[model samples]
Target: MATQIVTSEANTAAVPGEALEFDDIQGLVFFGHGHLKYSRYVFLRMKDGKQARARAWLRTLLERKEVSTASGKQHPGLKDVKGEHALQVAFTYSGLKALGLSPEVMTTFLQEFREGMRDERRARILGDTGGSAPEKWQVGGDATMAHVVLVLFGKDDADLDVFHASHRDCYQEALEEVFIQDADMRQGDTEPFGFRDGISFPYIKGVPTTRGSDALGLPINAGEFILGYHNAYGQYPFSPRVPRSQDPGNLLPDVPRSQRVSGEPRPKDLGRNGTYLVIRKLRQDVAGFWKFVEENSRDPDKSAEENEANKELLAAKLVGRWRSGAPVELCPMKDDPTLGADSARNNHFEFRDDPYGVKCPLSSHVRRSNPRDTLVDDPQESIKLGSRHLIIRRGRPYHDKFADGAEEQGLMFVALNTNIGRQFEFIQQTWMNNPKFSDLYDSKDPIAGDNYDPEYPGDEPKDYTAVVPGFPVRQRLTGLPRFVHTRGGDYFFLPGIKALRYLSMERTP
Candidate 1:
């Protein structure tokens, strides 16, 4: 028998007049499934003239309860649920069209999602030039575009394989496989770069958890992540809708009154409880990263142990955290494995005390990613401004070895947000890829930025220069090579359970 688990709705603090409907949301939004160590992502393209069959297969899966929801019981925290697994499905703009959604309804989605991550202009903004260009992508490229992505999680490889094979058999006739990406958490919370990742995440206002305030010191608005709610800007994030006449089966919920203009027709909400999902396959060069650090940290006069310490310090400065996930601002002298392991203390520090980036560089990966109090003079104001651009990250690391004996390993990056342009894309363009970030001179994110894109336009700096602040003088590390490259990526729409059913419904003739 399945273990009975309480829903988050019963445990979380309710919003003033409205409570989050956890049952309508996908489990990925609530939990990372860390207990399920193995994962597989299968990308599919629907077969020509097989829209009906695809929809039928989707309806069958929904009926069988294959797709997981945000229930505390179904969460990985529970133990010994037999054949326990998680299955999530998302679609691209092409996928929705392939499923027969009307053009009128499709236009309502965010333009960034409609144009996709591979659009020429977007690629430039995201620094997808040189080796990271879309043409070089293994999947989600022109020749390998996919319509749908099936995300599965399992306790082990065998469990994942069994689940994947079963689902693959069900949808094979309606959809053809485009690519298969597999990931595992064998690194135990550390990314391929040998630093603890996934250490920071935004806490939604209506989500119940024992964890305290996020690094920003408060819970962000639910509408920032989920549709049909108020965002940080005090307005509903735009969501797609279908005409009332089209939803004849009444499979979808009515659009909230606040979201509708007085003169417009009241449509059925297709994006309620749904959020946009961003997927990126980043290839991390572990050997290249370490080699660069080792070469740059060398000093003939220094002792071997001292050189090693310098190397470690340089790496930490680049990432803004020690190898064990401790923020360098708290323990800059050395690694504190114990402190890093403590969730309460590790993320509590702010950059205001070390304004000059003496402890953590202004251009460091973590600092640039989330500037916290440093964005403005007033810490509280900075927090409010930063909240508008937060994203809920759910990425995992993957390792694969090719037949030629070459090893490939990196992160299967996943992020969820309501507005792609305002949240995810803003972070990429304004923070990660900006050479002028924090007024730094010709520096991009040392770990993940597109620092050396040869095909980039204009006279932008082609090489990255890391700035490390010190008392008397600042240290500059130049000639840094690109450490991470984007292999494949795309924007997808992860619909609510009701929207899923609505998508599976046929239109009235």
Candidate 2:
């Protein structure tokens, strides 16, 4: 189901650990390749001595996790997946501390994860306000600190029912969980805004098919997403190190830290077979978003038929794709749902041909986010640069009626990357939030970014300009406000099974 690419990295080298441990890793990472349907994102806090007791409870829960390898054989018993229930567990830095992990180990984490995402200034940059602000956020906010997040994937509601029963039965010890919030999977892969998602995933180096991802010869360094491997730099990503004495059982990989061009040692290998996970709750203003599209879509002199056509055009330009998930570059004039439904035809378009900002605007959501040769002349260089900023997203939509005084729904934005600063944060700040992106003046990302024009600062009328290409006169739409905003989010580390077991301190090899 992957689009064909002429470029392939045939000589891409790989690190040790040929096969990924399905049980140790969470199935969410692979996107069920397409088998999974329902998902429950549960965030919980450690209640006092719950860490010690939770460790034991985690061991019991591990047995029920449905892990699969490269071969995705479906089980007939399950309605959605051919496999059993899928589960993955991750602990935030605070959660790790709650588990009694020493400060020495904790100090090695990234500052973004340590300091967190609560500052008002940063919130403004991320388009986080209203339902997405920390005040209304459920987890990883100033109000609540979640220690662990358990992602459970089931075939259907019946499957989730069974999971709830198992969770209750397994945790009879009164773990005193501080708080728990659940984000359910929507019926379709579409978000609340009704745009089709879960397309455009990266291809891994060693692992051939991640079910849902393309095995394009353009294989990315697995270390970019996983620990203990060669990254895009052909060197191991910077990770934490511990004394050999701490892991005497040889459960962890013996890899050097602070690797440059050559393999070198730093200290502990706490990051091997693990990746940094960023979880953010972004609430979409569904009504406000569509209203903006309708009001500003037409020119005063345009005919009724022309105005109706322009409405969809305006909305599609914002996302760089149609509601059917078709890229504007491929279907610039009209949405081709047939082409959009086909993965091969959907994502196989280039922006180099649209230099004058006609087909897809430079500041459009997809273009700003990925750029993809739109930034430079050489496709190879663009691909190489894009590879560095690539991230594996495991996000799902959440719904809560009458939330924030409105029907509340947003994406549980989860992503995995070796370098949080370089990958996730870079995209949010340098690309998505930056008002001036790729030579565009006074316009931020049309959808995700806050439409903040610095020229008209503080209480003045602020508006964003979108230049739509045309034959006679290019159409310009202005006065756009922020649509999507961040409510709450935090950084956590999703450890491999071995790493999780090692964190438990119960299974010593």
Best by lDDT: 1
The candidate maximizing TM-score is 1
Q: List runs of model 2 lying over 4 Å from the truth.
A: 1-24, 32-34, 63-81, 119-132, 172-186, 210-217, 257-268, 299-305, 403-406, 452-463, 471-473, 506-509
Q: Write the per-residue lDDT of candidate 1 for residues 292-393, one digit (tens) a residue.
A: 888877789999999999889889998999999999999887999998888777888788888879999998999988888878899889888889989999
Would you give me the overall lDDT of model 1? Answer: 0.85
- Candidate lDDT values, in order: 0.85, 0.67
Per-residue error (Å), model 2, residue 295: 1.1
In model 1, what are the clashing residue pairs, if there are any?
A: 5-73
Model 2 TM: 0.85
In model 2, what is the error at residue 96, expressed in angstroms? 0.7
lDDT of 2 by residue, 237-302 (tens): 876555556666776766553442253333557777778888887778788888888887767899
